[model samples]
Target: MTTAFTYSTTYLLDKSHYIETYEASVPADNSKKVYLIAILLALVGLAVLMLTEINAFVAWFIIALGGLEVFSIRFKKPWWLARQLISKAANTELTLTIDEHGISSKSIHVKSTLAWTDISKIEVTENGWLLYHNDSKNYLSSRALSDEAKAFLTTKTQLINALAI
Candidate 1:
């Protein structure tokens, strides 16, 4: 069997795609530290409120702080992504190419190529796939690709899986 696989497609990098790509780059942590901390903060605030009797300023402040922490955890990533992309790259036409060597992405705004070695993970999402790598991520949308090309990715995934074993 031939080992060479080359696929190329040009697609729009809109707000939703951008957000999804970057967000997936964050490793899914199963650790409960953050949740525990938030809960502790809330419980402490509740205790203070009960002991202080009838809505003390300090108790309310603690509660609000806990709430703010939870809010930050939920919104921080998308917010940061928007800031990074809002100025110029929020919407653009992106042409992506994948071969035996690496992945190359070109756009009206930017041009760059990420080597295959740079790709740490290939996550198949509902819409397409997320290419997670060192310090950067790339999103591949199925809108602009053919079934053959998508199948080629499946082959690559199998190769990766085999290597993992």
Candidate 2:
């Protein structure tokens, strides 16, 4: 069976969708651990400054900078990266079709097909599916697919071991 759908993409939805899919597929880095270590190191430095009678302002400034660093690492960086990536793409309409043999997609600038063998990974995201090729990725929004189409694609696509991630 073949399943197909079409939808127009917008920057905000696409951006959030991509980020959600990416976070699902890729594991978070050790940056959080690194940030915690940095916080500890900064506190040690602040204590050293106090013991040495260094300027009181400088010691407090180090502690303040460490707090800001922790805040950014925890909250700001992920959104900033999503904005940077999403800004690179132009809004366009997309058509996608999935079948037992392969998948095909078309946007304003590109049309392409990948056989089941060509797909390296497939990940189901919160709002859609992510298809990974050797050098590229494609997103198919669940909102565009009917229940029957979604079932067909899920069953057929899952049969391909090469595509399972």
Candidate 3:
């Protein structure tokens, strides 16, 4: 006979979870590329000013603007985009159940279940797992789960050939 294992947990959403989830889900901005292009533009403008008779003021202005762009990219401050999004439904309660059958979840505004076969992908984040469906994703925080539950989830996701990252 085989024994079945099930795990359940309930927790309220918090700011840190929201920020971490957002960082995991969204790709980093391409600031490096932007900065590189800015440098090239500034160099070209300087060359034109020195080699040709182009207006010195315009050339210098372009160079200064490029420098500013680089500074902005390097020391850019973070906006409240993530905070605003999290605040809208802050402290929302969520419950998750994981069993041999699959995963079932309930939250303030949504309730759904995803079978192992139906899961498109599973991404193991630094502090949680991202369960991907066709058009949506659910984030399950590691803090809410026991160590055994985490191991079970990792094993099941691997058995189903789900991509883990």
> Number of backbone collisions per candidate, in order?
0, 0, 0
Write the residue-wise lDDT of candidate 1 on 15-109 in tens digits: 77766666555555557676676777888989998976766788878888889888777777767776867767667887888787877889878
Model 2 C-alpha lDDT per residue in residues 1-165, reported as the tens digit of each score: 844543232233365555655565555675557598558857866896778688877877787778877776676557665664656343455566665567667766667787768777666777777777788776666766778668866765586544454
Residue 130 in candidate 1, Cα distance off native in Å:
3.3
TM-score of each: 0.64, 0.51, 0.61
Question: Which stretches in model 1 have alpha-carbon errors above 4 Å?
Answer: 1-5, 19-35, 45-61, 73-87, 135-138
| Residue 39 lDDT in candidate 3 | 89
TM-score of model 3 (CA atoms) = 0.61
Task: Name the candidate that leads on TM-score.
Answer: 1
Q: Which should have the higher lDDT, number 1 or number 2?
A: 1
Candidate 3 C-alpha lDDT tens digits along 13-88: 7777667777777656865675786788799879878988988988898888888777766543344444545464
- Best-fitting candidate, measured by lDDT? 3
| TM-score sort, best first | 1, 3, 2
For each candidate, the alpha-carbon lDDT, in order, equals: 0.74, 0.65, 0.77
Q: Using lDDT as the measure, what is the rank order of every candidate, best first?
A: 3, 1, 2
Q: Which pairs of residues collide in model 1?
A: none
